[model samples]
Target chain A: MADIVLDKVSKSFPDGTVAVRDVDLEIADGEFVILVGPSGCGKSTTLNMIAGLEDISSGELRIDGERVNDRAPRDRDIAMVFQSYALYPNMTVRENMAFPLRLAKLDRATIEQKVAEAAKVLELTPLLDRKPANLSGGQRQRVAMGRAIVRSPKAFLMDEPLSNLDAKLRVQMRTVVSRLQKQLGTTTVYVTHDQTEAMTLGDRVVIMRGGAVQQIGPPQELYDHPANLFVAGFIGSPSMNFLHAAVEEERLRTAVGDVPLGDRLRRELAAEDAPRELILGIRPEHFEDAGLVDEQTRGRGTEFEAPVEIVESMGSDKYVYLTVSGERASAAELEELAADVGADGFGGGAANLVTRLSAESTVAEGENRRLWFNLEKIHLFDPSNGRNLTLHEGRAAGALAS
Target chain B: MAASDTTVAAKWRWGLLDVVVVVFALVPVLWIASLSFKTTGTLTDGNFVPREWTLDNYRTIFSTNQFVRALGNSIGIALIATAVAVVLGTMAAYAVARLDFPGKKALVGVSLLIAMFPQVSLVSPLFEIERSLGLFDTWPGLILPYITFSLPLAIYTLSAFFKQIPWDLEKAAKMDGATSGQAFRRVIAPLAAPGVFTTAILVFIFCWNDFLFAISLTSTERSRTVPVALSFFTGESQFEDPTGAICAAAVVITIPIILFVLFFQRRIVSGLTSGAVKG
Candidate 1:
């Protein structure tokens, strides 16, 4: 219903702690934008500023082209679903959902009708008379959603709204949230620390770190081309494998093996400022069991042999953890990413690689397995700065520059 | 079989303990009721139950304007003091629980110190000040002291209750198109009702049962409460004992306290905020 613009909006507490800084975001009308990051990354703070729950220390916030920096949350016409659900326990489901409408001074009939419609949409018609104490966690979550949608506010700000559900319920409610957002066509700004939610729920994902916007792009675009080492590590499951690489003549010597530089990589490496030492990043899915790859596909990538440490079968694929002779990837950004996951010094300095192979492959633990990695998909990062050297043109450069 | 036997023994032990506590608490109350129904001749009899029951004691107390006016003063002063204390305490306790300002901890410490201070120590100074301020021997005289002494207790209890309420509900209300005032009244105040009621009952009881302040502050029947009036009670004749009539007034004043506890006890015990947030 409205486009939300946060132009260099920042939030700093009186004690001189900056919660969010220079966060510039432009969410189009009816667009579902997700702000994702680790805990204390300022994603929730930015969402609060957008919802008018927190004051913006600097810059402007506009809704539908009107500057609303001074507007109260009620005047801004926004609805927020808190992580805890925050249901009015004193009110029944019907009254809880009808709260916003009643506050708007809607007539009795219209409030009842709107609440009924929202309850039906959320499949909470059966629970209209029940208090929240009698409802299950998922039902309480739906009531929170119903409360937000009943009034059809200008935008919906969700702060980890689905994080409280069980794993199976979370998945079920993810689709429900997706469908509801699509049906309502309301501009939504959702904040979550869960990267999977960011990947699946938003039209565009805005990744943040240390109060600054890191990258903004569609899910697949960010997955395919992350702007930096943090995005590369933060966006994927099992995360992208990082290995220290030493640039040599026409080749990059890494812990796994010497990677022959293709023309595209060579072109980027030829820049005068390119470092002699770099970091190579490859996603887990990029590695396939060499025995299962076809001749044509095998020819497009490089094959290396390593001793497999563990093999985990995940129905459709096998996650193979392999160890090779090299030092682990070391960089400030990589350390911060590891610490974000409470994985300080994970796997030691053994230079282990996590590869996803076809489930049919017979790569058992303690066996030397030849893995094929797609060369074109490999990303090279500057060791000192964590910049992706291979991202040299177009949207990626623009995203990184921000 | 042994475990079941031990569990049965434990239940019996607890049941016996419960009986002891009930008897300990109820015996004096029943004794007072028994005394109220006794004739003046049997008032000192050694029997547990009244030897000769009579309606004469109740009839005597209600017949006089002295005891009736004192009862009226008790209700009026206690009700006003409780209402004012709860209102002012709720606001102060809410600020203590939720808001951060300079000297917040100091305010809490000071209120707590006031709660721990001896009320008997303030009676003399209060009597002097009330007389100079023209508050002596009036409802406001007793009501003012009652409010001041009970306010700290109300604030402490209400603040503890307010601390458990999730702050998110208020923010959610605001985002749901409610102004700050509406958010508090519609969302917060209702959730805080049990605490408010609990604090109100406590303040009421404190004001109702206060003897020192009532006796010290009032010198006339116009403002004397039941407890102070009982001390000043004279028999039908100077030689006659007023024990039966005094016991009757005691039972009457106790009825309101019992009713208050019975009426709002359920509200005080309900976990009204249990489902307000994710647990």
Candidate 2:
């Protein structure tokens, strides 16, 4: 295993198009780090730079405390699993798995033994003599994984290796990949645009946008405490509901209702340089049916009644979509995220909020229902900069405890 | 019942068209075969079939040193030219398909210009140059022009095949601890073998079928290919006709082409149409 460090890594093409900006990342030995963002976010570019497939324009990349920025991909002693699997079409599974060992000049017995071991782990023993074209999609993916693990390289680099598989197969392979990485204990850098994979697979997730690293932390930390509006909206499944609000006397005046600012938020808003206008962020799971909340527990949050536009029952919970009378949050980050998720009318005047209510709640479509949003879970962001103004100093620690 | 009736009528029309096409393509070949089996006395009979068949024409051509030497020259020159062209074309095609070097477009444009250039225009200049260089009656003279003309065809076909190969395999190979050379030999070359083989057959056919260059560049049987040698065939005396012998030689030359197409027809079809669609 190797520790990979990128010090101010950047990648720019000859035509002056910057694919990756100055980004610093340190992946620990045997750590599974995921670089994730929307398409064109340069996550794959960063992984390519680490793999030495793409040249670093103006920075140093050190693997195992050795400067390897100029090293060839083979010389770097890394293995990459491509989205296309990239298995040699002419080679059988045994030959494909044994390729790196053969290239490294391993003996025949050792190469065969290692390939056999990998095939057993990947359940590809029966397919050892089958060419890649004859394998199914999942089998091809397993072969790609088998090829990567057979070498036991310094690190593993996977670029959307599961993206080509069907959703059911993708989930199955995700567990297999995670298990393999743990069994081998190799430092792995996985690049993907799917947030679910990023959250589930990586030990630490790096959220990036526009070729820039926005945040690097645990998946739960990014989920509980997003550093900016983009991460807040990008991390969660249903995504965080955003509403435009104006700072006022001891309260934030939003279109839904007046929300009383807690002591922490009041102190943050009273700062000398605080802006009068801000964006309010709340995750969908932070809201509950007001009727289900007890009196003492109800005091910890605020309640507002709105007509439910749509209700989707997902067995465990109901996703209630509500239209509140207010201007939706308008920021470049949210707009880009809306475009990324294909959420139409996100920035329209009527703010649409999706709240996950318990299955026990009897909320019907087109009926007015009171929803209680956790006040403590609310995030306030600076509209101009997209910075989460109310982000606590120990929020990441708090996320870990919860 | 109506659908079945229409299907029957359509099958009949298609069967008629297939018969017409097969007859149109095969009649000349049958005629040539008949001529090759006919005796010299029956050569001028002007009948579709020979009254009496004989293998004497084949035996005569096989016995003559002139035909034997020309046949040997044809095989050697075409094989050598094809081997050289395919190797160079593979390298050029791979680079054109995968690499981003300056003047790539210019190289493609030049090859295209050469592919479309009229061969008749270059024959005179090439003939003069070969004479000046003392390569006038050598196999190298004919091989040179054959390679030059076939390079563009080889490059276009091979490059189209190369483009269909996922470039990611090379990167994966590198990550799998393969040097660039190793990656090409182990991963790319094997994948590209069918395409290279197909291109080799095409280039060989082009060189083997050349009559003008073989005749103009060489003055004797020393380097004269079969096509040119066929023109020199005279039945023993001025009164004799060499038509049967010529037909025998033509049929012999066509055997290899027919076998190649029959063996690799599927591969040739796929190689030609591979990159036209995204898989």
Candidate 3:
């Protein structure tokens, strides 16, 4: 296993289009790091640069403390699992797995032993004699993984490897990949646009946008403490709702109601040159039905009544889409985030808030219901720069836990 | 019930068309076969079937030096031209399909222009150039033009097939520690074999069927192919008819083509239609 480091690496095409910017990343030995972003965000390009499949326009790439920027892909001693599986169509499963070993000129007995061991681990023993064209999508994916792991390369670079499988099979193979990575402990750099995979698979997730790094942290840390407006909107599903608010004396005033600032937020605002207008960011799950909360717990948060436009019950939780009477929060970062997620537009006119409520709560569609939002969990962002004003110091200290 | 009746009538009409097509294609071949089997006395008898059946025509052609030598020249030239054209075309087509280089479109455009160019227009010039270069009447003379003319066809068909292959396999090979040459030989070349075979068959047929180039270029029996040699055949003496021997020689040259098509019909169909649809 090896630790791979990208020291301010950047990739620009001959046509002067930058795919990856000056980004520095250090992946330790045996660590699984995920590079997650929307399409055209340079996640895959970064992975390709590390694999030496793509030339780095600037900066250096180091594998196991040796500079490998100028090395060929084969000379880098790394294996990659492509999104298409990329199994050799003409070769059987055994030969596919034995390819790297054969290229390395290993003896026949050793190559056979290694392929057998890998096939067993990947549950491909029964399929060793079958060509990839005869295999199902999931089987082909396992064969791809088998091909990568059989060589026991210094690191594994995977570019959205599970994206081609059906949803259920993808979930199943996700665990399989996780188990294999843990068992082998190979330094792995995985790239995907799916946030769920990034959350469930990586020791740390790096979020990128417009060919630049937005934030890098553990999934939970990024979810709880996003660095900017783009990261806040991109990290979570039923994405974090943003509402335009104006800073008042000790509270933030929005069309829904006044949200009183906590002591920490107040102090932070007082210390910095705060902007007059701010964007209040709240996750869907951070909201609860006011009626379901006990009086003691309800005292800790702010409550407001808004007309619910739609209610989708997902068995365990209720998603209440509410239309608050206010202008929607608009910023370049929010627009880019909306476009990235393929959203038509963020709050065409009035603010639309999606709140996750307990299923037991008696909330109905088209009814005004009281919703309580956790004030302490709320994130405040400056409207002009989109920088999260409420982010605390030392928040990313726990980002690199393996 | 009415729909079923219509379907039955439609099937009957389609069967009638099939019979017409079969007759249209096989009649000339049957006529040649009949002529080859006819005795010299019945050569102009105008009977569809031979009145006097004999194997003398086949025996006469086989026994002569002219027909046999021309047959050898035809086979040698066609095979060599097919081999060279397919190899060169495969390399060019693979580069066109997989690489991003300047003038790529221009290369494809030039090949396409060559494919569409009238062959008769180049015959006179090629004739003069071959004579000046001392390539006239030799195997290399015919082989050179054959390879040149068949290259565009070979390139168009092979490149279409190459484009159908996913480029990801090459990257996977490289990541697996195989060098670029190994990647091509081990991963790409095997996948492209059927396409190459289909192109070879096409190039061979083209070279084999070209009577113009063979007759225009060769001045002697040394390099005269079967098609050109067929025109020179008159029975053993000036008075005797050569139709029977010529028909027999035509049947001999066609047998290889028929066998090739019959054996590789499925691969040829797939190779031709590979890139017309997305997988």
Best by TM-score: 1
* Candidate 1 colliding pairs: none
What C-alpha lDDT, on a 0 to 100 scale, does residue A303 get in candidate 2? 90
lDDT per residue (tens digit) for residues A1-402 in model 3: 999999999999999999999999999999999999989999999999998888999999999999999999999999999998878877778888999999999999999999999999999999999877677888888888999999899999999998988899999999999999999999999999999999999999999988899988889989988898889888888889999998887888897699877676666566667787889888999899999998887876789999989999999999999999987888898887788767856356889899999999999998889999877678878878888877767352110111
- Chain B superposition TM-score per model: 0.97, 0.91, 0.91
At residue A86, candidate 2 shows an lDDT of 84
Say which docking band candidate 3 falls in. acceptable
Runs with alpha carbons beyond 4 Å of true place in candidate 3: A248-250, A262-274, A394-402, B1-12, B236-241, B262-279
Can you write out model 3's per-residue Cα lDDT over B30-56, one digit (the tens) per residue?
Answer: 999999999988889999999899999
Candidate 3's error at A379, in angstroms? Answer: 1.1
* Clash list (residue pairs), candidate 2: none
Worst 10 residues of 3 chain B by lDDT: B270-279
Evaluate all candidate structures by whole-model CA lDDT and list the values in order.
0.90, 0.88, 0.88
**Each candidate's chain A: what TM-score?**
0.95, 0.96, 0.95
Question: For model 3, which pairs clash?
Answer: none
> Candidate 2 chain A: minimum summed lDDT over ten consecutive residues — where?
A393-402
Task: Please state every model's RMSD to the true fold in angstroms.
Answer: 2.8, 3.1, 3.6
In terms of DockQ, which candidate is stronger, 1 or 2?
A: 1
lDDT of 1 by residue, B1-279 (tens): 999999999999999999999999999999999999999888888677997989999998999888999999999999999999999999999999989989999988888888889888888889889999999999999888888889889999999888889999989998988888898899888888899999999999999999999999999999999999899889879998899999999999999998988888878767798788998
lDDT of 2 by residue, B186-216 (tens): 8888778779888988998999899988888
